[model samples]
Target: MPGPPILTSPPKASPGDRVAVLSPSFAAPGFAPAVHEQAMARLADLTGLTPVEYPTTRRLGASARDRAADLNSAFADPEMRAVLATIGGEDQITVVPHLDPTLILSDPKPFLGYSDNTNLLCWLWTHGVAGFYGGSTQVHLGPGPHVDEVHARSLRAALLTGERLEVTDPDESEDVGRDWLDPRALHEFGDREATEPWEWAGPPKSVTGRTWGGCIDVLQWILTAGRFPADPSVLSGGILLLETSEELIPATEFGWIVRSLGERGLLEAVDAVVVARPPASSLEVRPTKQACAAHRQEQRDVAIETIGRYNPDAVVVVGVPFGHTRPQWILPYGGSMTVDGVSRRIWADYA
Candidate 1:
C-alpha cells in the first residue's frame, strides 16, 4: 500500500516517547477491571513503554466535562508524546459539546481509538488538528487471548512509529465474545474464522487525500445533532472513511444516512470512501455466514449509490477492517490516505 500524502500535524512519537492512555469514554473497569489491567499490561508489552492512567479511566458515570478535562490534560502535558483512548463508549457526543479545542489543536499528536471515539476524531479535524483513527490499548491491545499480529503492527505504526503500514486480511478471525470476567479466558485467543481477501468493487484509480469519517453509527449521531462536518470542499481532497459498528444497522438504513449526508452537501465533498465490513450483530447473522456476507455487500452497494447519487465522481472502496471488529487496522483521521483503486490498495500515512 502507498502511504498517503497529506500532512496536518508534526509526528509526535519516538521509540521511547511517554504516551498517556486515558478513558475519554466509559471505563468498563468497574464492571470488568481485570480486562482493564490485562489491556494495560498488554499495551506496555507491545510498545516498550509505560502506561499512565487518569482518575476517570475506570471510573464509571464520569461527567462529559470530566472526560473532556482528562483529555485536555493529557494533550497539554509536556511529558506526553501521544494520547490513546482506552475503549469507546456511548454518548461521546456529550464530550464534543464541552471539548476545549484549544488544548488539543495547539500541541497535536497521535490520538487513537474507534467506535464512540469518532466524536473526537471529527472534532480534531474540524479544529484543524490531525489524529489517527485506529488502535486502542483495550481492543487491539487485547484481541482474544493474544493480540493479533495485524492489530499490533497497525497500532505500532500508528503510535510509536509512522511508517507505511501493511494492510492484509487476517488468515483467520474470531467473533466469539468471552465474559471479561472469565479470568481463564483472558489467557486464551478468542475463536477464529477464516478470512476472505479484502476486495475493491470497481475499476482501478488512486487518490491521495486527508483521512476523515469514523464509525457510521456515530456519524449518524453527529449528523442528527448538527455536528456533522461543514462542507465537501473542505474535504475535497481527503479520503473519507466509513465503517459499521457491532449494532449491524441495515443496509437500506445505511443508504438513507449517506443520502442524508449528501443532502447536507457531504458526499460531493470527498474524493474517495473507504467502507468497512459491516459488523455481524446477532448469532443468526453469524450462523449464516453467507447471509452475513450478503448483508455487508448490500450495505456497500447502497453506500456507493448514495454517494454516487450526489457525486458520481467519488471513489468507494469496501472492507478496510478497523471498526467494531477483530483484526482491526489503524486509520489516520486528519492525516493522509492513499487509495489505489487500480491496484486495489489503501494506506494511511501518519509520518
Candidate 2:
C-alpha cells in the first residue's frame, strides 16, 4: 500500500470533448427523463463538453455486469475524455468487481461521483488513478432553479479547467430535494435552510494531503468488503473525507463508524479530517427545523470528540457542503487538498 505519488490525476478534459454520463450504480436518468435531459443540457452549457450515454445509462435495474460493460466501453473509447455518474445508488460494490481494470489503466479519465460511487472511486484510487468525489447530474445539475454556483464551479474545475479552488460555504442547503415524480422537481429547489458556519477543531496548524473516504455508510461497506488498503499506513499524513447520505442515520451510528476507523489505525494515520454536512431530513422523514439543527449539531459533536480521542492533533472540520447535500463541492478523492486550521479554509487541487 503506497500513498501520494502512487495515484495520479488523469489528464483534464477540454471543451468539446466527450464525457461519459453513466449510471453505473442506479439508472437515475431512466426514472426521471425530464430532469436527466435538463441536466445533460446544462452539463453541456456549463462546461462546453458533450454528454455521451452508454447502453445501460438509462436502463433501469441493469445487471452489474451490464453496467460494468458500459463503464468499460466508456474508458476504452478514445473519444471519451471523462466519466460522470448520473447519481449514486446502493449496489455499486457489485459493479466494481466486473470492471475491466486494463481499460481503466490504459485510458484513465476523470471519474466524478459520490455516495455509492465511492466504491468506484476507491477502486480507481487503488489502481493509481485519482477521481473527483462529488458530481451527480440527477441531483446537482437537474431539479433546481439552476446549477449551484459552487457545484458548477467545481464541476468545471474537475472536468475542464483543472485549477485549484477554495471550497467555500454555500450559506444554505437542503437535506433532500422534491420527489422526482413531482412536476415541480423540474425547476424548483427543495426546502432550503440557512447553514451554520463550519465547525473547526484540533490544533491550529495547516496540512495539505491527498483525500480519501466518502459517504460513511458506503465506506463501512467498502471496509467490510476488504476494498481498503491492508496497510493503514498507506493513508499516513493524508486527509479523511467523511459524509452521510439521505438515509439520515443517527448520530450514534456515525460515532460508531468513526470509532471503528480509529480502532483500525486510520484516525491517527491522517493529518486532517473533513466531515460533510450530513443530511438530517429526507422526503418521507422531514423533521422540524429545530430537530434538524439538533441532529446536525450532535453529529458534529460526536465527530470532533471521537477524532480527538484517537488523534487530538488531527485538524478536524465538520459541515462543509459535499456528498448528499445540495451546493456540493466536487473535491478530489485522491488528489491534494489544503486544510488550513489557522485560517479555517479549504482548497482543493483539481489538477
Candidate 3:
C-alpha cells in the first residue's frame, strides 16, 4: 500500500465559530451531564467558540454507524468550523470504518481528540489531514478546578491560531482523577505527584519530522485492524508520540507491544520516540504511592530497553506531558515536531 501523504493542518477555527462537540466514541456526556456542560462552558470561555452538539453527542450506547453519521455531519456542516470529541472510548475502532472520507476531505477542519480518538486521528492522517492529539472536552476542560494553562495554550494555538509552540514538561502531574459521578467532579481535581525531568537516550542529536502515534493500546488496535500504513517506511524520520492509557498494561506487555512494533519495522523507521508518562495508578487499581512510582520506573525501563533492541540510534525521550494524565499537552497529529536529544528540548509546529 502507498504511504500516507504529508498531511496538511486543516484551517484553524476562529472565535465565534461553531465547533462541533460530538461523542464519536463513548457517550461521556450522557453519563456526566454536569461534566459535559462544564466542558462546553469551558471551551467557550477559553476559545470564544460556540460548542454545538450533534444527534449522537450525548446519546448513550449509540451504534457505530450512528456515531459515524454524527461525525460525518460535523465535518460536512459549513457552520461547524472544528470538531472535538467529548472523550475517548475503547471501541472507536468500530466507528472509524463507518466514516465517509469524502465528507472530511471536502471540508477538513481542526479535529481534536486523543486516546481512543487516535483511531480517527490516524484515519484523518491517512487521508492527509492533521489533527490535535489531546483535547477531550470532559477530561481536560471539565472536572478540574480550572483548565490547565499548558492545555489551554496548546488548544488555543491549535484552534484559534496556527502557531508553533514548545511542549514543556509539567512541574507536577496526576494519573488519578475524581469520579465523574461524584458532585465534586464538577470542580475538584485529585492529587498530583511531583514529576521527574524528561529522560533522553540514544544518539545525542536533534531531528524534526511529522508527529505520529498515540495511546499505545489504541494504536495496537488500529494496527491489528490493519488501518496503519502497510509500508513502515512511510514513517521514516517521523517522531513517534506514544503513551499508555488508564488500563496501565504491565511492563512485560508494554515491552511486547513495543517489540511487535519493532518486528513490523516501525521502531527503526522513526527518528525519535516521545513516551508520555504512563498512568501508574487508577481508581480500579489504586496502588500505593510507592507502587505507582515503581510501576512507572518499570515502564520507562522496558520502553528504553525495547527501543534500544530495535533502534539504538533513535532518540528516545520519556515523561512527556500527554496521554491519560492531568496537565496534558495537545500535540498535532501528523504535524511537524522537533526532538533535540542533545539539548533536551521539544518543539511542535501547531501550524
- Measure candidate 2: CA RMSD: 1.0
TM-score of predicted structure 3 = 0.98
lDDT of residue 233 for candidate 3: 86
In candidate 1, what are the lDDT values of residues 1-351, reduced to their tens digit?
222333367475765668888888877665677777888788878887677888788889999999888888888887788888888888788888877777776777778888899998887777777788877666566535778778888777777777876466666655545656677657765555676566564436788888778988898888778774454566766677888776788898888887877887667777788887667654334547777677877886787777778877767777667776677777778877888878777776766
By descending lDDT, how would the candidates be arranged? 2, 3, 1
Q: In model 1, where is the ten-residue run with the lowest total lDDT?
A: 1-10
Worst 10 residues of 2 by lDDT: 1-10
All candidates' lDDT scores? 0.75, 0.94, 0.91
Candidate 2 Cα deviation (angstroms), residue 269 = 0.4
The local lDDT score (0 to 100) that residue 10 gets in candidate 2 is: 95
In angstroms, the error of model 2 at 313 is 1.1
Q: Residues 110-163, candidate 3, lDDT per residue (tens digit)?
A: 999999999999999999899989999989999879999999999999999988
How much does candidate 2 score in TM-score?
0.98
Give per-model TM-scores. 0.91, 0.98, 0.98
Stretches off by above 4 angstroms in model 2 are: 1-5
lDDT of 2 at 289: 94
Model 2 residue 156 distance off true place after TM-score fit, in angstroms: 0.3
Worst 10 contiguous positions by lDDT, candidate 3: 1-10
